[model samples]
Target: MAPTDVNRSTAPLSPAPAGGVPGWPTGLTGLGYGGDYNPEQWPQATRLEDVEMMIEAGVNIVSVAIFAWATLEPAEGEYDFDWLDEMMDRLHAAGIRVALATATASPPPWLTARHPEVLPQLADGTVLGQGGRQSYAVTHPLFREYAIRMATVMAERYKDHPALALWHVDNEIGCHVPRDYSDAAASAFRSWLAERYGSIDALNTAWGTAFWSQRYGTFEDVLPPRAAPTYANPTQQLDFDRFSSRALLGYYQDLRDALRAITPAVPITTNFMASSGTKGMDYFDWAGDLDVISNDHYTSAENPDRHIELAFSADLTRGIAGGQPWILMEHSTSAVNWQPRNRTKAPGEMLRNSLAHVARGADSVMFFQWRQSQAGAEKFHSAMVPHAGRESDVWNNTVALGQALKDLAPVKGSTVRSRVALVLDYEAWWASELDSHPTQALRYLDQAQALYKQLWLRGVSTDVVRPGSDLSGYDLVIVPTLYLVSDSGAANVAAVAERGGTVLVTYFSGIVTPEDHVRLGGYPGAFRDLLGIRTEEFYTLQADEQVSVTGTSGDLVGTFGADLWTEKTHLAGAQAVAVYDDGALAGLPAVTRNTVGSGAAWYAATRLDEAGTAALVEAVLADAGLTGEVEAPAGVEVVRRHGSGGASFLFVINHTGTDASVKASGRELLTGAAVSGDLTVAAGAVAVVQEG
Candidate 1:
C-alpha cells in the first residue's frame, strides 16, 4: 500500500479515527528510529545540517512541531506556514518521514492572555499560571476551539504532503494537569455525571450522597470533587477521576477527529504517558480511539529496576494495542533532564533499553528529541545528537542502533509471544489507593511491578493486560492488589480459572465495586466463590512488624517471612498452602489454593519479600502446568517476538557487568553473529536471535 492509500488494513480497530489500523505511514519500511525534530529552534543553515545528520544516523522519521503552536499561530485567526512548508519539503527530499504534530500541545501566550478563562484550575480553587506547558483546561470549550482550529489548518496543509507519514496529536496529554477543578470543569463534570448515571436520584444513590447530608435533588448542584471541609465522598472522587480521564481523552478525540476528517488515510495518534509516573487516563479506555497505540516512557534514573519498569510499560502498551505492533513515540536516549539526579546511561545500556521495548512488541523505537535543545526547559534532556555533537558516544551509539534496527526489520509487525497475563487496572489503582483505605502503605504500582519484576527476572514474557480483556490464550493470570473490580471484571478473572488456567489473587484484591462501594459479603467480596476463601478484615501490619509463615510440604518452608499486611482468612473450601506461623493472625491461611473446575485459584493473604514472591510465583506456574527457572542467572532478560509461519526472534539482554549466554541456534541480528548452542551477549548489551 502507498503512504496515502485508504485501504491500509482489513481489520481496523473499531472507531478508528484514522480510518484504518494505525500503523507506520503507508509506504515507510523497516523499523522506525528518530526523535522530536524542532527545526524552528535552529537557523535556516542548520536545517540542511539536521537532514544530513539524520541521514548519517539512519533516522527515517522525526516527530515535528510538537510544541510549535506559538510559532504556527502567533495570533488567533492568524497563521504562518512558510517555515513549516520549507522544512517539510526539505525532509521529503531527503527520504525522511514525519510524525507531524498538530502543534497544539501548548497554547501561545497571546491566546492565553486574551482568554485566561481557558487556564486550568486546582482543587483548591487556584488557577494555574501560563509559562509552563499543558496549561489549558481540557474541558474548556474555548481552548478546544482554538486547538481544533490549529489542527484543522495543519491537516489542510499537510494532508497531501509526501513527508507526512503520521498525524501526531498534542504531545503527552494529561501529563501535568491530569484534571482541572475550575468552574468550567465543574460544569463539564456535572454533565458527564448526568450522562453516566442518567438522573440526580441515581447519582445520589451511587455516590451514597445520603451520608453527611450530601444528597442532591438535581445534577446541577453537583461539582467536581474539589476541596472540601471533610473527606469528599469516595465514590464522587472515583467518578471525578474517571470523568477527568475521560475529559482529556475526549479532548484528544476532538483533535483526532478534526485531523481524520481532513486526512482520512493518514494514521493519527497522541503519545500516551503509559508508565507509573502517569496515573490520570486509562489508556485501555483510550486505546479504541487510536489507530495505533503510541506510548512515551522514560525510566527514572532514581530506580535501580528501571529496565523492568520499561518492560512493564512496554507490555502494558502491547496489551493496549491488543498484542499488535505499536510505536514507541518517546523515550530518552540517555539521561532525562526532569529528575533531580539525571544520571547518564552506562555504555551499551541504551541499545539494551531500546531493544527491550522492541522485544516486548514496539515496532517503531524513537526518543524524546532528535537534538538536545540549547535553550528552554528541556535543554539538558539527552537526545540522539547531543550538545557535544556527532563525535560523542551518544551520537556514535545512535548511528549504530539505527543500523541495528534496519538489520532487524524482519521482526517488525510481529507479536510478542507470552503466556502469562498480568492485570493492570487503572481504575482499581485509583480507588485502591484512595485516602481512606485501610493502609496507606498499599502501593498499587509497587505491588504490580514487583510481581512483574519476578516474571521479568525469570526470563518470562508477560503481557500486562486490563481486567476484562480476553484471557483464554494465557496459561496464568496474576491479579495484584486489585481492590476495585466490577462484576464483569471479577467474572473475567474467574473465567480464567474455570477454563483450566491458573490464577493468583494477591492481597487487598476484589474488595470494592467500580463505584467505590464495598461488597456486602466477606472480604475479597468479588472472588470468594472462585477462590473458595473469605477474609473478615484486613490485618494491616505496622511499619516494622513481621509475620512468620510455613509452607505445606517441601514447598512449605521453615519461616515464610511476611510483612506490611496480613489478613484473617478462613477457608470456605480452599486448602491452605501456607499458614501464618506467628503474629496476631497465627495459624491462619497466609496462602491458600483451591481447585475450581479444571483450573486452580490461589490467594495470597499477605505481602511477601522478594524471595518468597519468587517461590510463590513458581508454585503458581507449577499449578498452571508451566515451568521456568524460578532463579535464573542474574541480569539476563529474555523475550521472544513471534512472527507468522513459526518464525521467532529471541532477545537476550545482559544488563550486568559480565557476558551472558543463551541457548539458541540461529543468527543474532544485532551483530549478525551465528549461534549454535549458546548465544553470548556482552555486558550491558543485547542480542536478537532468529532461532531455529
Candidate 2:
C-alpha cells in the first residue's frame, strides 16, 4: 500500500481538556505515543515514510528540533526553517502533534568558533570544545544572548503552527555541562552570593569562613572552590553547586521568556534528567517554572532492582509536579546505546515499563527518538521503529501499546494519593556527600531507596516530597538521612509529630544546617528534642564491621544486626525499643520511641540491614494504624490512581517470570471483564482495574 492510501485522518486526537493549564495546546485524546523526531537527518522521501509509519502505529506527537541549532542556523545571522516547515506541515496533515524544541541545547559550530569564551571550562582549566552537546557555559553572556535569539526566532516562526502542541524549551537542561568553573562562572557566582547574603560579612558567617583563616574581605576574592590544595570549604562548594544549578535555570528562563513573549498561549517545559542519584539541579525548585512537568528516565540493565528504582523516580516526579499528571519524556523502547553492554528488553518489558510510568501519574510515555539513527553518537539507541523496520517486535509493541492507551483514555486526569510521605531534599544529598564526612561509605540515595523499597514491598503508597511541603495530610512521615535541615524544615518535621502523626527519623539525620554547617550543642541537633534523644558522638565503622542488635519490646524483640554506622545516644525522654547487644555503645539506645503530644516519634541510630529495616518499618506503620490490605508477592506491584468524581483505578503489575495473584475486585479496564477475588496476572504482564 502507498503511504498516502492509509487514510489516518480519522485517528483519535482528542482536544485538550478544558481543565488543563492555559496556553497549552490540547486534543490528546489518549495517552501520548511518540518520541523525538529528527527529520533533517533523513532524506525528504524517508521523512515522508517515517510519518506514514508513525500514523500507522497511532503516534500522535513528536518532539522536533532538539539538537538542530547547527542545521537551523548554519552561519551567523543566517536562519533556515525550510526543512522544519515542511516536516511540521506534513506531520500536521497526517494528524500528528508537535512538541517543538528551541534547539538551544547545543550551540552551532560557527557561533562557538566566533565566540570561544562561550565554551565551558573544567575545574582543571581545560576548555571544552564544540562537537558535544551542552558545551557552552550557561553564564556566558554571548551564549545566553545567542541562545535567546535562536529561541525567539523559532518561537516567532512556529508559535501559530497547526501542529504545535507544546514548546520544549531545551533538551534536558544541565545534563552534560552541569558545572563550569570558568572565570565567567566565578564572576556570576560572586554576584549570586551577593544577592543571597547581601554583604561580605554575612557570607563569611554563613560559610563559617572564620575557620582556618578563610574569611574573605570582599566578594571578589571568592572563587568556585575549584581544585584546591586540600579540602576546599564545604560551604563554598555547596554554594557553587547551588550557583551552577541556578545558572542553568537562568538560561532556561531566558529561552522560556523568549517563547512566552511570542506565544503567550503556548505552554513551555524542559525535560529533566530525574535519574536516581542525580544531584546537578534541584528539580523540586524547578518544577514550579514548568507548565507541565516532564522527565527522562533510563533504567540500569545491570541492577537487579531497577523496577523499584523506576517506580521511585516516577513517584518523585509526580510529587514534584504537585501530584499532577506529568510526562514520561524519554525512555527506551529496547536497549539503550549508552551502557557498557546494552541489553534488549525482554518480550513484554517495554510495555510493562511504559505502563508503570502511567500507573504512577504519567500522562504520556515517549522515547528518545522516533526512529533509529544510521549515523551519530547514539546510533545504537532504540526507537519505536528500530533499524529492523516495521516487522520488528519493537514496532509491533508500539502499535499494541498505542491501542492500549486508547483504552486507557479515562486515566488521563487521574492522580495518586498516599498517606506516607518520604522527605527527599537535594540540599541534604549535597551536604552529605561533602568532603570530611563521618563515613565515606554513607550514600544519600541508597539509604532513601532502602526505606522506599521496604514501603513499596509492603504495598504502601508513598510520595517522595520536599521537607517544606505540607505534612498534615500524611499519617506517617519518614525522614531518611536528612543530614541538612533548615529551621523551617525542622519545624515542619516537628509539627508532623505534634499534630498526632507518626514520624520516623533515621540515622545520620539532622546533623547539619542548610549551609552545610554542623548544628552545635549535640549531634542530630535540630531533631534532638523532637526525637527525645541526644547523640553524644558518631561511631564510623569499617567495611567489614558489624554490630549485633536485639529488640527489647514490641516488633523489635527479634535479634538483628546493623553495619556501616552507629551512634552513642542518650535517651532524653524516649524509651529504648532496641539496644545494641555488643559494641562500644553496647546497651545504649539503638532505636527509641517517644510520645510527643498525641503522636509519637521513632529514631534509628544505626544503618540496619534489609530485614531489620523492614521490621522497623512494619512497627512504624503499625503505630500509625496504616497498612495495605494487599499482600503482594516479591515481584508484583500494586498502585492506585484516583480520578475525578471519586473514580479510582488499580494497577497490578507482575514483574516476575511466573504468574502472580492478587485479591482484587473491580471491572478490568483493559479486557472489559469483571474481576473478583483472586486475579492471576501472567508473567511480565499488567492489569488495570477500575473500581466502583
Candidate 3:
C-alpha cells in the first residue's frame, strides 16, 4: 500500500477544512518532542538556563500551566495573564512551540471551599476535597464558568503568538474519580437522561428497569446506582457509567468550544488515561472535538511488555484521531517517583519508547517536566535537569535523545498504510464490564491487547478502530471482546463478511445494546444469523480447569485451552474449527467459522493465550489474502508512516537489553544504510529508514 492507499480504509478521503483538525501546515515535515514546561515553579534566572538545556535536549514543544488555574484566575471574576504573556514570549524567542493549557486542572482552594458544590464525588459516594488536581465537579456551574473564563482569557491573550501551536484543554478529566453526586450533578444527570431517553418511561424500557421493580416514574426518582452485597442492578450501573462519562465530556467540550472561538486555526486537545474501564468518558466522543488526540502514559515497571502496551495506547490515540498524527503528551524521562516503586528508564529506554510512538504515527514526543520540581507530588519524578542540575546522567541522556530526534526528524506525521484493522470500542468496554452475569475473568482490554500483539509481532501495520468505521479496504477485520453490538454494528460486520473480507468476532460479543440491556433474542443476538451460531449457555470454569481445540488448518493443528467464560455453542451452517478437548462439556465448538456471502466470520467461544489467539487469527488472515511484507528481526520492531511525496519512512526500534540483527531491504534513512538483511541494531537503539 502507498500513501494514496492510506485513506482507502477511511470513508472520507477528502482533505480536512482549512482551519479544521487534520490539516498539516506548510513545510511541516518532522516529529516534535518535549512537553509540560513549567517555568512558573522556578525563578527567572534558573528558568532562562532551563530553556537552553531543553533546546540541547531536542525539546521542540512545551506544555504550559497544566495546574495553574488558581493562579490564572485567583478571584471569581478577576483574571490574570501577565505571567502567561512573559512565558509565551520567552518560548517564542527560544523557537519552541507551545501547547497552551487551559490551566483548569485544579480549582483554587478558595473556590472549592467557597462553593463546596464544585468538588467531585467518588464512586463510593465520598466527596473529594482539594487534595489532587482532578477534584472538580463537572456539572458545577462555578467550575465551568471559571474554566471557560480562563480558557477564553488565555486564548485571547496568545491567539496571535507565533509559538502557539495547539490548545491543551483541562488536564486529564476523570483521572482521579467519577463525577460528583452533589445537587448540581444530580440535577444534570436527570437532564442528561431526558436527552438520552426522552422520558422516564423510555428510560425504564431501555434499562430494563422492570426487573426488580427498578423502573423510574420520574426524573427526581433517579440516583447514582450503587451496588451493595445483597443487591446489584447491572442496568443501573451501566446508566450511571454513561451519565458520568457524558458529564465529564460536557466540561471538556465547553473548554474546547471556548478555545475554538478564539483560535480556530490551532488544534485543541486533552490527555486521556488508557484502559480505565470507561467509567464513561469515551475517547471517541472526546476525540470528536479535539484538534489532535494526546495522552499522558505511565506504565507499571513490573511489566516487561510495557513497551507493547505503550504501542497499543499510541494506536488508540490514532484511532481516536481517525488515523491522524497524535501527540505523546507526557512520558517520564527516567523513573517516576509517583509510583510505589519508582525505577529509572534504562540508558536508551526513553529513546526506544519515544521512537515506538513515532513508528506508530505520533507527530510529537513529550515528557512531564522540563526541569525537576523542588515541591509538589511529582517533584521526585525524573526530568531533563534533575534537582541536581545539568550534571546528571538523566540530563546527558536527554541531550543525546535530542540529537537523535533531530537526526530522525524526517518522518514526522508520516502515514503508515495498513490493510489490516482491529476494532476496539470503549462503549463495548463499558457495557461488558458493567455486566453482572459474565465471569469475573472476562476482561476487555487485556483480550484486545493480546490480539494486538499478534499483528504487532508479525510486523503487520494494524489500526485500532471502533464499529461503524469503514472496513471496505482492509483484508482482515479483527474484533476482540466486542461485548456490545447494535443492529447496525452487526450489519457492518456482516457487510464486510459478505464482501470477501475475513472477520474474527470473539467472545462476550452481542451481549448488550448501547443502553446496556441484554439483546432480547439470544447471545450474539443481532449477529446470530450472520455468524450461523446460537449460544444456549456460558459457564465460569475454575482457573486450573482446561480445554483444548485442534485447528482445522495451519500451525494451529494442536489443542488449546478454554479456561473461563466457556460458551456452549451450537453451529448451524458454520463448521467447528476447534473443540474443547476435556471436561464434560468437552468436544464442544470452542471456535467456529461461518461462510457468509463472500467471506467468513470466525468466532472464539473462549479466551486463549497470545500464541493460541494469534495462531487462530493468522489462520483466518491467511484466508483473507493478507500477508506481512517483511519480518522484523528479533527485538527489532518495524513500522512505516508515509508523507506526500515518494518519501516513505520506516522506524526500526530495538527495545531489548541485548543487541539484535536486522535485515533491511529498503533504504535506512537514519543511518544512510543501504538495503540488507544483515545489520546489527544496538540495544535500545532506533534507526529511522526511508524510501526515496
Rank candidates by lDDT, best first: 2, 1, 3
lDDT of 3 by residue, 101-219 (tens): 88888888888888777787665677788876777777777777877877888888888888888788888788776546676677777777777778889888887877877877898
Q: What is the lDDT of residue 30 in candidate 1?
A: 86
In what order do the candidates fall by TM-score, top score first? 1, 2, 3
Residue 625, model 2: Cα distance from true site in angstroms: 1.1
Candidate 1 structure quality by residue, lDDT tens digits, 47-145: 889999999989998999999999888777787889999999998998999999999989999988999999999999999989999889978888888
Whose TM-score is higher: candidate 1's or candidate 3's? 1
**Clashing pairs for predicted structure model 2, backbone only:** 14-27, 14-29, 15-27, 16-26, 16-27, 23-265, 551-556
- The local distance difference test score of each candidate is 0.86, 0.87, 0.75
Which segments of candidate 3 are over 4 A away from where they belong? 1-29, 74-81, 227-232, 275-280, 552-555, 665-667, 676-678
All candidates: CA RMSD (Å): 3.9, 6.6, 5.4
lDDT of 1 at 201: 89
lDDT, model 1, position 483: 91
